[model samples]
Target: MLQTDSMWRCVCALVLTFPAYSTAVSGVLNSPTNVQLTSTNMDLVLKWDPPAGAPRDLVYTTELILRKPLMDSKPGCVNTSALQCDLTHLVVSIYGRYTGRVKAQLGAQSSAWASSDDFLLDKQTSIGPPNVSLYSNGAKLEVSITDPVFVHSSLREIYYYATYNITYWKKDRMKELKHISGLQQNRVVLHSLDPSTEYCVQVQIIASTAQKPSTPSIVHCARTPSEKEPPWVAVVVALFILAGVLTLVVFVVRHWRSLSHFLCPKYAIPEHFKESLLAPPKSSLYLVMQTSQPVEEFSDQISVVMCSRTEEDGSKKPAEEKR
Candidate 1:
């Protein structure tokens, strides 16, 4: 009975080891599915779905293949556990066509690469929103655009060939849409705008004919400056008026007595009194008288009187005489 138990145990061990050995020799990893290529402003990205029933520890490898206008470059990613790869570091021409592939890999076994649909770099790639800056220059608005920089060296060349699409309008009037396209320069001047008016501006990137335009940038606003009055001009006018008022006040204070006397004098003569003093006398008269005292004591006392009158004809006559 002990010998029978030992044989049974050996058979159980073989059965267990056989299955593990066969799995290592015969098992092949499955290919990744749904491989796709997409682009952002900064880089091109390759993505794939893991194979169904793949092991929890399965890793992936990715490679980029140039299809048109062929070149000798093959850029690849290796031993990555993630589902996505960034191929922006590869320096391929913007006009060239590209395709990508990915595969599932175990320790010693790897599946066939699942290829992605072909795409052109310029046609499929996208660029980030441009940096917008605005300034008010009198009645005009100055707009400036700046392109975004990528982490990959190969993607920087897109900025050189990129053109811009700009749109601007008054803030209150949304129906009036003004668009400017194919602008190579970073700065543009908007003219014939009302002073102190609010305006909104937006910008997008158009890399080439093959590429779609980038998403529009955030709206930015700026106001044109209002006209200003000169400070010196107002000050000068006020000073002139003040000087005139002060001069008038000084003249009145100094000559107040003279002005009053000229209006009403202190001494004056009446006309009727002056006429009486100038008229001549109409007549004149004269008179004389005499008296005796010592002779009248021995005899009788005697008294005598005389008078004369002058007329307007200058004749004089004695009216009465006594002896």
Candidate 2:
């Protein structure tokens, strides 16, 4: 019975000592190790490794402490089983200094917090692509870019400044790439392009040396206007046409008389008919008068015969002829 009593006292003492030992063990848990901070275009992520001898089912919680010019904010991740936490939805300042820390928890016990080195938000975050606009100049293409405006409440700057990497190519000839880099201005002019040709352009944002460039903007397509004909060319063509028309008019005027005669001739008697009808009658009369009688007797006979013929035809002779 005495041995049993001693065993009971010893058991109670051991039980009391066990609680203190457990408490001490829980307090000495090693902190998480190798904490890291990384970022995407829109969000920040915190990652850490569990300490040695950490339980397989150990859960992690994280917190972000931000220090800005005039403000301080604390955003936390609670009761998460993941080794990494995404603090994207937090309303932390974009232009602020940030530090992320993580702690591992197993049931009621928790490890010490592992903190990351101080980092600037903009230094770790990438800028988004800029908006692009295209215009059709006569023989050139005009490209205008609008830089991204950060809308975080903590960001007081009006605009985010960035350099641009502009890439353009002809739609039909995509193998040939044209690039313009380190351009600080928002607008650029592309020259020596074929008139009325299809072209495509894209732009990317380069914010700082630490941050990588953002994704390229959506491709913009535009066609340059067609070329205009020169005034001198039109004038020369008009002069040639006018000269040709005038030459044709002068040729027609010079040949008009010959053309008319060929088309229509006047009606008249032939020279051969006049000679055959009049010459024979005159020759026969002359021969008859010479062979028949003397000139005076022939003339008197011709007059008496003409008078007899005139009376027989019911015509009267003049008084001078009768005498």
lDDT of each: 0.79, 0.77
Model 1: ten consecutive residues of lowest lDDT: 285-294
Model 1 alpha-carbon miss at residue 255, Å: 25
Clash list (residue pairs), candidate 1: 123-210
Q: What are the per-residue Cα lDDT tens digits for candidate 1 across 1-323?
A: 99999999999999989966775788677799999888765467899999987788999888888888884547578989999998877746666677888988898898898989997776676666788999888778999998765544333364457678889999999799799998989999988787788999999877655357777888999998885567999999999999999999898789889977888779766777778767654434322122323454455545555555667766666455433
Error of 1 at 220 (Å): 1.4
Flag regions of model 1 displaced more than 4 Å: 1-26, 53-55, 71-75, 150-162, 172-176, 227-323
Q: Which stretches of candidate 2 lie over 4 Å from their true place?
A: 1-34, 40-43, 47-58, 66-75, 82-95, 135-138, 151-161, 172-175, 182-185, 208-212, 225-323
Task: Give the alpha carbon lDDT tens digit for every residue of 47-142 in model 2.
Answer: 888788676887888888775564555657887877888876664566677888888777777877789987777666656668999998889999
- Best model per TM-score: 1
